[model samples]
Target: MTGRPGGAGTDIGLISLDEAGARAAARVAPVPGVLELPLVEADGRVLAEAVVARVDLPPFANSAVDGYAVRFADLRPGAETRLPVLGRTAAGDPVGTLGRGAWRIFTGAPVPDGADTVVMQEDVTLSGDEVILPSQSRLGANLRRAGEDVARGQEVLPAGRRLRPRDLGLLAALGLERVRVRHRPRVALFSTGDELTEPGRPLKPAAIYDANRAMLRALLARAGADVVDLGILRDEPTDLERHLREAAGACDLIVTSGGVSVGDADHVKAALSACGSLDLWRVAIKPGKPIAIGEAAGTPFIGLPGNPVAVFVGFVFVAWPLLARLAGATAEAPVVFPAKAGFHHRKKAGRREFLRVTLERRDDGAVIARKHPGEGAASLASLAQSDGLVVLAEELEQLEEGSTVPFLPYAGLLG
Candidate 1:
């Protein structure tokens, strides 16, 4: 077990996942700036202000289907009725008002005055200008009301909303060509350990390729933060201290992978203290336990584990949310669905365990979670083979086959 230190501003002992999260959240704040950007450029950005709809969605009440527009009272239920068609109305065009007679209308065509209901063209018999509407019990069923989707002057998107593709389209519909969004927090990234080498380069002796940096870069980018990769640093204290100090001045946050754990070669904790206070939080989570939260010269720093899969899980559980908060976005936890366990396993209590799992449907058509065969913090294949994670809660100690458990798909957690 790694030992905790006092007098360095680091927390003592192993803390629960909730406790670690709360501490991290309390320490890190939203970056202090906003930017006005075009709609296209605002994709994946957090909205700094609520966006109100300038016009109602659809803009006007129109035909929901190609049919005849008439008064609901005019047609008797279960009886045939016939009336002369005044004219035809297509999408984006207006036809003359409907009298006591019927008027032909197409989908998206503005409903003329005096008409309240529409019957599909398929349901009606057409002969020249006369449209025969069969008896229909449903009245005013086909009319899509104006502002049904979104009303004018309504807050279409609240502040702190992370802009998605649909959000962009909605903003465009509101006639907003640009939006005020929070500036993406600039993150400085570095990797530690002499055993680590760049992926493309040849490894020397006991050195292994650095996978943490690349994974972190993608994760940070997907979270909508700008990343400045400082590459891999040797285990030397002087090298680590120099790079971290320089990064502190220019970056809003500093992220280091590998040297977070207690090792003689690890200088990240020392480096953070030299620049700013460092907190090594041993979170109660499987795969990733040692996560460090600190600051270097007013820049927030998050130290992640070196193991590839641990780095992935750590980011998903802690760093990801922290980064989102810094970007002024509301944290969206992964959507979890209850599923039956396909296998049985028991683990030590107290720690929240996340097992990579693939979902399957039984002959009865119920969803079952099949745990991945391999369990290793450094094994990326397990994450690749599995569709999502089976989250064993903090208090759970044993899992039996067919028992319901919460499963989170990769789509929800991964950026």
Candidate 2:
């Protein structure tokens, strides 16, 4: 028997976090639907197909600065040359060929034909009807060429890419009004245990407000999933079975918190068995171990541990990859950077651990990861007060002060 909180047995060998993530990703299929959305509403959605450039970026040759456009041959070598200023051209104005003269051009204005160089206004002296250019100006300097940024008919974006704000700007520059994107995965979410009470309700003896459902809803929303909140479910076996059946029928995936352990009150496994199938995975990870991965009525299901911090870790590390694949998006890995440990501590062997830590730049020009004072998995304040997590691999038995460790910032994980 394993010495976990619920006294469950680890008959299945402990799965590595990476292997568990891959298994979870392989269990579900992408949601089978697509929709065309305007560019304004397509941010955070996944592209359904590859997009090709319809027109060249910039679409024409223009000036890179507010300056004078002149031909390279007009400048004299080793001496300053004066050229007559013919006319002024602003952005979107018509251009005329240069005839042994220079044209005053503003930023983004088209360069005149037969002109091959632009001299910045600050670099040249402006005399009446003439501009004095320096003796050393390279041909084609400060002039933007057409089709330099992106050529027409080139594939600008690939399939399964998540659209960002800047991606919308790119598509807009290509003159695309709408794009086809994968529909958001519909997720049915709920919390278990008779002791869970909704927030703002009267708290009875031995009951806490249901924080997991609300937190999970927001997390799923941020991951681009349409959530179907099924509220808190009691421990009754028959009621749990009914709810799972309904959720499986209506949603692409089912997510639940708690009730997956071996205790008598924990009934998620039995409920899933009645409706479909369940596999209890004891992953070799700290704070979260007993994860339920299965399918209910042919729809995928993921049961996370009840602890708040455990839920956060399981969702970020395990469930997110599955969600990403189901949404038809390219998998994004969290960036990990190195930092020195500020404190020394021994950890349990054979399990990966993530400690909430705040970073400080030392006088020696090294960043140090300081572990939070509280190490409990239920400590929400520790999560809020800390910057991110410092990961310790399963092989690491102890961490020494001043040792380099990998740090994962919240910005990198959440974004």
Candidate 3:
């Protein structure tokens, strides 16, 4: 037996949320190798190879402003110097050298030879076939040097980085048609509960739709896993055994929502223990206290709680990072920033808590977290209505209004 004293009798002990996360991270081995993808298709893929740039960004000395390109030495002090506008130079148009004169140049246009600076159109008055240059315009003013944005041979995208849309665009600009990225991990996902039914089916008199299945599947897929949904299962010993074995064989990671708690109907705990190794952890966190981690049929399994919010907590805090690691990515923790509390809050001292909160940007630029009135762990609506969560440490019994606390925004977690 392994668990906390109040829960299912188990040899495993109650661990803090931090310990649970670190433990989950320690258990995963990143999948090896890579696959080449076209630049447009590489968005959201983890880079397996460092991308070195072949050429300097911009690739030429260009104008940073839509004005005139000229020689800095031609202007005299305290007086405006007039020069002929020999020709117009637009972006991608290269002009001949400027000899004691000016050329009308649009933004990004290459600066002609002998031209040391650019002057904004607003700084000088344009006369017919000529422009007035200010004597005060300094050398190199408004000039965009070649390779200013990126230098050739620089590491543009480092290895183990998850590529974003901007990365894709940068790689495209660098003329890399293909990029090598790690293959997504295949995950087996399911939910276990005798009282649950699938949505869109006629509801049984006493059963609820298995929301965890859909939710977990979505979370896994969004985290870059190839999801193999195993659907809902009963607490029956034989059924759990069969599915657990099958999932272990087919998936790189296995996840189940329900049947890992202290209840007598916890067939997931029993099945995992009998099939292989199991450590049912009692994590010291609210909404989700009972969680399990182990191996079955040589595959890793993470068992989360049945409550909708608990499932969310476990997936966000553990399973997502586990998947990222297995997919050859460095799983960075979600950023928690200091935010002022708009209302007073209190909780028991033994466990950590995450409360749903809406953030308001104060006039002074301080972020304020307004907690949801309903604090129920099972209140899924609270999670839906709030923008982020205000994290309370285990020893924090109460937080007063206007006090600083850490807030984890949903935008960072959902991605």
lDDT of each: 0.84, 0.89, 0.84
Listed in order, each prediction's TM-score against the native is 0.94, 0.95, 0.93
Count of residue pairs whose backbone atoms collide, per candidate: 0, 0, 6
What lDDT tens digits, residue by residue, belong to model 2 across residues 1-415? 0123212332237777888888788888889989999999999999999999988888988999999999999889889999999888999998777889898999999988888899999899988988999988889989998888999999999999999999999999989999999999999999999999999999999999998888899889888899999999999989999999999999999999999877899998899999988765578888888788888999899999888888888988989888999999998889999999999977666678899999999898899999999898888878889999999877666688888889999878875
The lDDT leader among the candidates is: 2
- lDDT, residue 160, model 2: 95
Where model 3 places Cα greater than 4 Å from the true spot, the runs are: 1-12, 361-366
Q: Once model 2 is optimally superposed onto the true structure by TM-score, how far is the C-alpha of residue 231 displaced, in angstroms?
A: 0.8
Indicate the TM-score of model 2: 0.95
Best candidate according to TM-score = 2
lDDT tens readout by residue for model 1, 1-415 = 1112232333346788877777777777898888899998888999999998889987878889988888888787789998888877889785468788888888999888888898988898887878888876377768876888899989989999999999999889878999999989999998998898898898899989898898889999999899999998988877788898899899888888988778877778887788788765578788898788877877778888888888888888888888888988898878889999998987666677899999999899899999889888988889879999998876666788889889999888865
